[model samples]
Target: MLKENLVNILRTLQRERVFLLGSFVTLLIILGGLGFSFTEASEGGSFLKRFGEGLWWAVVTVTTVGYGDVVPKTSEGRLVGVALMVGGLLSFSLVTATVASIFIERKFRRERGLETLKETHHILVLGWHHDGETLLDQLLRRLPHTARVVLINQLPPEKMEGIRAKYPGREPLFVWGDYSREEVLLRANVRQAYKAVILAGRNEGETAAEVDQRTLITTLTLKSLSPKIRILAELLRMENKPYLERAGADQVLIRGQYDSSIMAGALASPGLYKVVDALLNAEGFTVWAVDVPSEFQGSPVKTFSDYLKNQHQALLIAIFSEGRALSLEDLLGDEPSSIDEFIRSKFVETGMTHLFGRAKMKFQINPADHQVLGPHDKAVVIAAQPPNL
Candidate 1:
């Protein structure tokens, strides 16, 4: 019974207008008593009569229904009654306005599932968790400052607000919904996004099967909607990597596999880890992709190196043929019918890695090994260091 009463009290408190009404009524009664007492002391009226008049005055002041039936003759009594009346009205209005707003917002959200987006070429982040937040911070740091990132998560407003307060600056537009649903992705404007990052949901006690199921659903939905959008997903399990890739994700970062691969490479050579870390971090030995023009069809790789030193102030790294192959052959001597063919032949001759679905230039490989020049080939060069480091 006691718990029930407490719950009732909390419910009543939530209906703030009722509290406001009761407060106004109580204030009126108090004001009336004070007014009657003051009038009695001044006019020498009977105690009962003074009390009655004071009650009347208090009621009128509190309700703002001043009937002028009983008046405050003393300056002190009048001032007190006036203060109480103003306080009562202000308090009542504030409470009523707050209650009304709560109802209105709830109704609005019920009618509309989520908000819309306007910016183009922006990134869309699905789900909100520790991993999501980390990815958001990294993207904000890496991408151009003007780029917009929209967050779609299933968390409530209070929870989302708490997460948002930690990040001060232009916050990403947030869409709260179950990310597995196609409607939620559509609401987030996934179709127009430049990239989509699907993060793993935190399911501490849940079975791995359930978690993988959820991740696969989200990935499939995103691909179905915008097949062209570059989807970078994080797959927790190694077995799920193929599913994510088949779902059309441009890149899948398998946490375990990636770490293991790096570790394995590092075990072979300690410097390998440092180089890989620097390259991935876009720091120290950075890699940039520089384009090769059509006019330089027959220009040797050496000429490009000279140009980088003098013009772009960058070192000429390995060039990716139009077919994305790194080669160790002479590019100028091998005259091909088309630039694309030339790059293809050169890339095959030299062993290089090409990241999928992205244009590239020469980067951290042996440029001396591949000396081919193609209109579409590029050079990825490292630039300067971070500021204030």
Candidate 2:
């Protein structure tokens, strides 16, 4: 409490520094001179008369409104009055400047404080309902390191703990305000933000269109202020999607009545949801891209098995030919004419044949397939490291 009081006192003193300093100095000079000069010079009088005269002089001198009502008779009193008059002019000016500086500073500080509170870059989610939490959770999970996610909702801090816990290190800056207010947009720093996602509260009895209309006003205001910020809004009805898109939303993620179709399918086939989940989760039979190498240009499929065997360390699938086949003789090269004759002649060396189909076929030539091979222009080979099954 003492620390807080001291801080408050310091701030107050700073705000009124000029006025306080001038007022105090003016009082000290007036009182000091009055007491010393009046004691020797003034004729014996009531204490009240002396008190009133001293106060009158202090006020007039400090305000630079000197009216010659009472003149100092003693040389000492006159000297003090001359000093007070000079001091009074400087103090009056100081007081005026202090008041003006405090007023201007307060206005600018309030604006800057609001701006700092609303700094957001990635998203501005407008409601704190269950769906809002779910949406935030999904986004946070997908982009774990995202820095700025802003929430504009009136829910108190206690109710937002779930979001805090789920995100762990990522918590959005929250603002308490009505979504329809223009000031709320300014508070959220919507102008400099990247995108906005507005959600409707489930408890609100109003139609989705009605709720969306209020959100749309905020979106339009934000867009007008910052034309580059993309808006992604949510709607309860599918019919409202077009309206939201027309209202300048880059994308409107809306709830549709199409869930019934999925439910009907699920009821007919119990395993449908499982299959859908597998595909969506990327848990099975994933697709991967392997870059082609520069060394395998014009090399025969049977000549590059070392890639899959030694380098890739995976199964060698079939290789496909790329581009139109050049001269048949160049493709056929020097393959044995007949298997029986070549074997009889003790020449059973296997060689690549250029022709029967667009691409050549080889059986488990893993070592040759593993060689650095260029990408095919026509077809790609499918290789996979099968999980233990």
Candidate 3:
């Protein structure tokens, strides 16, 4: 852990270039102090004879803020002082120029989306479409203000600037490159990202199949880099959903999958689509799914619903679970039964070994009122904000 922390600190300093400035300053101070103390040693009981006093004198001299409180009384001491003064002027000028150059280079790199990010647990949005700005806006609205985001794409710097301008204080970092490439992902710090949202690219002249293929490759690359990262991917065709899932995406959303149903509903009943749109896109209120609190375990669905409504002003409309969850140890058992071997063999044969330790997610909307809440059960509700409970 200590070594890992040290590596992380070094990585941060390297990215920020703070170590350069610190090392230069420390070296100059130490050398100046040692030289001053040795040269003034003949002056017995002189404050400059002490290393601490020499350091103070060195600081004032290097900064050219001579207080005249400590002066060299001998030829050797004066020679040392002259050397320090010349070194200080030359060194500080070089340092000032170098610092300015560094800042300018960093700014240029950032504006051109060529900078490597150091943000951890940030959300990564890869690829882009014509309506990508809307997706970014929604993500920013849903995420907390403290949440960091990095966007990886080939969009122009001007486009990125316009997008940043739209959100005054919540602008996301940008990396200009092909999102499917591992190098670009590394530049965006994909290994440290909490989650990644892969969108189907609408690059000029690219077909839908090509776009879906790119999305699949991006998902595979991301999972290889960070197996624990949660990936939410968009698919242009419903047929590509299983491929994306096999690529290790946590969730796959097919473009316009619900459009037909919504359109039919709107035709059958006037204003139905408007209601659906409001529920999904309206300000102030939206749907959320929260795990059942321990205190409400085994409570009836109706009871829990009532509690949410009364305590948090949230309307509970559904109770659901992500299927029957099981751990690897539970499936394998201590004795390693034939059944365990059989399950393991099947997972390996299907090239879905990763799924062996994961539960398949499924949602059951609006369960019976008398149904009791289980440990894995979650309540789906419409609320202004997430409830504290």
Lowest lDDT sum, 10 consecutive residues, model 2, at: 347-356
lDDT of 1 by residue, 248-291 (tens): 46667765567778989899999989988887775655666556
lDDT of 2 by residue, 267-290 (tens): 888698666545334454322223
Q: Output the better candidate (2/3) by lDDT.
A: 3
In TM-score terms, which candidate is top? Answer: 3
Better of 1 and 3 by TM-score: 3
lDDT of each: 0.65, 0.56, 0.79
Error of 3 at 298 (Å): 0.5
Error of 3 at 341 (Å): 22
Clashing pairs in 3: none
Taking all chains together, the TM-score of candidate 1 against the true structure is: 0.53
TM-score of each: 0.53, 0.45, 0.75
* Tens-digit per-residue lDDT, 284-349, candidate 3: 778888889998898888888889999999999887777643443433546765545654554455
Instruction: Estimate the overall C-alpha local distance difference test score of candidate 2.
Output: 0.56
The C-alpha stretches of model 2 lying farther than 4 A from their native spots are 1-120, 277-389
Cα misplacement distance, residue 107 of candidate 3 (Å): 4.9
Best candidate, lDDT-wise? 3
